[model samples]
Target: MSAATDRTATLYRMVMPQHTCPFGLKAKALLEREGYTVDDHWLKTREETDAFKAENGVRTTPQTFIAGERVGGYDDLRRHFGKPVADPKAVTYKPVIAIFAMAALMALAASWAAFGTLAPVRAGEWFIAIAMCLLAVQKLRDVESFSNMFLGYDLLAQRWVPYAYVYPFAEAAAGVLMISGALMWVSIPLAFVIGTIGAVSVFKAVYVDKRELKCACVGGDSNVPLGFVSLTENLMMVAMAIWMLRYVF
Candidate 1:
């Protein structure tokens, strides 16, 4: 087929009164983004949609045709154009990277707004504190799931299941206190003890035992791997605790 012919796509999608197919919209957008001249066709009724599906031997709408050949659904079209389709179960650091990046930005913004300049030292502290709060929020959303995942590698959590449930709250408390530079007595110990325990637990699990597991750092449902990133989180908490101690002593 000619390149010009390949650039012309025929799309059949469902646009019902009650609901429009999201995948259909996605397919159209994707085709346009890839420089295709899309011949958009909508099946406005269930009967028409069913008839089209039956005639074409396809179970779903958002079907795309290129050069007289079917390219299937949205996912298939993506693959046809050599695009990477997302896999939910795949291990990735994207969540942690996003959290840290946003935390850094928040810290810098806060520093600039409050002090009228980018206070590097203050921003650094805020970054860690904010990151802790964000990570705690992820765990707090589904404590049960987080605890279950935590139990897999945390030595303390393995021995005492309740510690898993308490972990998120402790982290959050420490983070809030750290942010305010108040309640050092509570925050210091909480951060220190938990951080030390977590560091040890992660080390033994990943390095000592050489176990491969998903990290509960982002939450229980995440696909983030248990390794360097998890270890770094614990170490940062420990470091924050020590950093706060300087002010007390």
Candidate 2:
């Protein structure tokens, strides 16, 4: 590669006390990380920034130029390097994994406080309850979004529609009741019914139909895959319902 093409890039970034642009800092860091010698240009004043934008016929700061061609901003720079830029609408397990991690931690803490020990059985109960509640909270954030995503794979929701709306509330109610060890009659049945439906639906969608899709178990907005994690969630609920049923009956 030629020395100029191999080593250099031009970066224009905003650097002011009141309006220091974060993307500008990220762009500089990215360039350095990727071993590029950056010709760093700072827009120190608002007028200077405005003038730069007008001159370039662009409206955003922290613009990059490689080989004297405008490469836009931070996200654009990432693309230029073939890095994965996060898409907000994309499906991912990040949200679901985060909730499960937090739920387990909360369960451990609660178990310790209540039992003065991590009682294995009780810890399992607490973990499932907290996980259910946390997942329900995500779904409740935007029920309509959750329902729409849910209908894509959920058998009952696709047919009944209203079941999608009711699912979150039922999950939350079952979770809360299980936590308190109260109203097993209500919680057990609720858990069993939903868990059965969800398990069957997920099995058919992924294993039977061979359709790849997002799981609404975490929330409508999540990118959690419709597979093992989802199946496990349903199975946990089903097991909890049966376990709790033994106590009630």
Candidate 3:
């Protein structure tokens, strides 16, 4: 190894080793698990902690400096988990509120369909239309990173694939048809099937055995909720899709 490479072997860390500090312990344990000896300073003195934070931009302990780069706090440590671990299903995953609303609207629109419950929001499937629009907003602004510490366009060096093109476009197109109110019969079902597949696939991919892949889901937020997060999320989508499809077809 060249001198530059050899120097890389030493992982730098600074922490006020204490029981009360979550960030401090998390940062330390994570590094130790990764096989790097922590070079930490117990900053009991106010002057020392202040100087460290001022110099390093870390008011939080244990503050981590890896290879000369400052990674802040414990949540920031999740950045190391990598993007490859991203659940593919999350690509289409949406929150429960959005999913339920879409289904409710689609049901309300249809008189002939068995589900009159979805009609309130089903004006030509406007719910899907607006969702696409909002997603477009999120995609443009890159809200995914709003929740992520490390993964961002910066990580990919600016290369990115937006869901608008990858999946939302399809969702939007299908939604438009349903909301147009012309095909309450056709568009509703289309939405359901498409949404279901998207939801179910991602739910499985996230919870099931999958490889490490960076999450490209939302601009960058990788702080995921624990426990079969995939299942409930995907299930809702699948159910919404089925419900929509039921009326449209």
Candidate 4:
């Protein structure tokens, strides 16, 4: 094939009434982005799709062909163009980092709006409170999953399974009350109790026992490794509890 002919490619993808293949659309877009002229073909019926798959010796749709050479699916096309493929099992701190960064910004914004300036102490308090609320939201999304994961390293949760279910709610309640500067009696004690337990659990599990595990702080489905980040979360809670204690007396 000539160099110009090589720039032209053929794509066969599923586009049925009930379901259009998402990867097929992605593959076409990628080919276009890479400056390829796609001769797009659609397998409109199940029989046609099955026939095509059998003919091509393949099991999936959204197949690409360049200069009579089959290039597989969307991921294959990406690799052909030297792009990185996503791995679902990859460990990452992105979720926790995003939560913490957003919390910091929100805290500053709230401080400015309420006090007419970015009050450092107030922002700091709000930062921790907002972080807790956000983290709780993650766990609350899948309470059962969070509880199951929490039972892995949390001493209290391991002993009393019910605490696993209650932990997120307690964290959220403490955060909300701390933010409002109301009911320190409830929030302070709750934060302190949970925080102390969490810190000890994390330290013993990671530092002393040295067992590798995934953190449930972000959520049960998280890839964040159980370590300093989880420890920091508990420490922050404990610190916030102590700071808020001044108001109780």
Strongest candidate by lDDT: 4
Ranking by lDDT: 4, 1, 2, 3
TM-score of each: 0.92, 0.78, 0.34, 0.92
Which residue pairs clash in candidate 4? none
Model 2 C-alpha lDDT per residue in residues 95-175, reported as the tens digit of each score: 778988998899989989998998888888989999999999999999999999999999998999999999999999999
lDDT of 3 by residue, 1-249 (tens): 455432232222343445345556666777677666676656666567778778866556666666666656556655763413335456333543454465445445553374544445443344445444443344335444533421221212224444324444444455556445456555455556545654444544445545334333333443333225434433544454565655644
Pick the winner on TM-score between candidates 2 and 4: 4
Q: Is candidate 3 or candidate 4 better by TM-score?
A: 4
lDDT of each: 0.95, 0.92, 0.48, 0.96
lDDT of 1 at 161: 89
Error of 1 at 153 (Å): 0.5
- TM-score of predicted structure 3: 0.34
lDDT by residue for model 4 (1-249), tens: 678798999999999999899999999999999999999999999999999999999999999999899999999999999999989899889999999999999999999999999999999999999999999999999999999889999999998999999999999999999999988899999999999999999999999999999999999999999999999999999999999987777
Candidate 1, residue 241: CA error in Å? 0.5
Clashes of 2: 2
What CA root-mean-square deviation does each model show from the true structure?
2.0, 4.1, 14.7, 1.9
Task: Choose 2 or 4, whichever is better by lDDT.
Answer: 4
